[model samples]
Target: MRPLRNIFAAILLLSGAALWATARADDGAGRTPTPHPPRAQGEHCVADTDFMRRNHMKMMMAHRQDVLHEGVRTPQFNISGCVNCHAVKGDDGKPVSFASPQHFCRSCHTYAAVKIDCFECHNSRPETDGKAAATEIDGEDAARLAAFLRETKQ
Candidate 1:
């Protein structure tokens, strides 16, 4: 009876191993793996010119101190605002994007001696989708946004 029990235990162990191997094989064979898609043209959902005009100052203010630091802390804000504009389709055929204070904000900020550490957390290129571009903003809309930024500064 003891010998029979040992045989049963061995059989159970073998069955488990076999099942695991079969599952792995099945997983591999279940579907044809998709190839990575190509990089999309343009800067994703960002409004190239308007985005540059608006929010540049606010972003600069947020990163000014960090830019001066040799070892800066990770920024408190994520790229959501910038991503709202810069979001683009990714190489994997999914939405991907980034927003760097340096890329969008540095030109103006540097003129004012505001050092920006844009590379710390933000990538030079952000991914985005067309959702951000669907909004119909006129010149007045851009001007208003710019005015709001100016108000924030004061």
Candidate 2:
């Protein structure tokens, strides 16, 4: 009976050690990488209706055809809606002079435990003009673009 008790205790200790080792192996060197959350789907501003409504910001309404007819190409990637206006440029021709809490999306998200990775792939500034012109339309392009934006919804 004494021998059986000793064997059982040894088996339990070995099993416990094995579990500890596996847990440490899975965790690695105590600096596990945090996984980023999936990006928001669809157009950036299109799904921000609630945000726009709360902030009293104007919503972009132009359709693809309207934008093309007006000679305005929609930006491919933009973090802030209408970034051309919101972002301030410096003498160096770079976007914004300083980074703020408003711009540091990761800060609040980190506090809330939501991970974001916008800075990894996107530039802080918005892309405006392209190297080659796609098409040419009549009338004032800016005015047409504004009008087109005024008529579209998400």
Candidate 3:
């Protein structure tokens, strides 16, 4: 009877250890630790750090249609706003572009295994203040577009 009692006690101890281990594992799975946001040279963000960390994607998505379709550009949601602040300078003092992992966006995106397509169509660096708005459509294309619009109106 004493041996039986000892066996039962051993089993209980093992079961408790197993339960503790399982609970600890489940806690981790529920919220895997995220990598810390990279420190940029800029001290402040457009939004609070916590808010930006959580909902930046949603903010950018909403701003895209507003800016692109409506031509309503605002400082707060401009992609250049982010680049101007977040871009890390290279050895030459020019910014490292989004293609590099050292870039603020790429660092987090790479850690999360997320691929962003924004840079494919947009400039990765902040545009120079002296530079005029450069359009991809050249003079011939502009004239052709004007002619098409005129012909369609008639």
Best by TM-score: 3
Between 1 and 3, whose TM-score is larger?
3
Each prediction's number of clashing residue pairs? 11, 1, 0
RMSD of each: 16.2, 15.3, 12.6
Q: For model 2, what is the error of residue 154's alpha carbon versus the real structure, in angstroms, after optimal superposition?
A: 34
TM-score of every prediction relative to native: 0.23, 0.25, 0.58
Task: State the displacement of the C-alpha of residue 52, model 2, in Å, after optimal TM-score superposition.
Answer: 8.2
Taking the tens digit of each residue's C-alpha lDDT, what string does model 3 give over 1-154? 9999999999999999999989988776545455555575566777898898889999999899899899988888888778767767666776656544456776677567666767657756655575522324445444643453344342
Task: Name the lDDT value of residue 49 in candidate 1.
Answer: 48
| Worst-scoring 10-residue span by lDDT in model 3 | 132-141
- For candidate 1, write residues 35-84 as lDDT tens digits: 32233344553334457356655655666556556446453334445533
TM-score of 1: 0.23
Tens digits of per-residue lDDT, candidate 2, 1-154, equal: 9999999999999999999988987876355444332333235544464574344222233433445477666653223444434454445564431132233333234434433344333344444573221223334443543443344312
Top lDDT hit: 3
List the global CA lDDT of all models: 0.47, 0.44, 0.69
Candidate 1 vs candidate 2: which has greater lDDT?
1
Query: In candidate 3, which residue pairs get closer than 3 Å at backbone N, Cα or C atoms, i.e. clash?
Result: none
Model 1: how far residue 80 lies from native, Å = 4.4
Question: For model 2, which pairs clash?
Answer: 61-152
C-alpha displacement of 26 in model 2, angstroms? 48
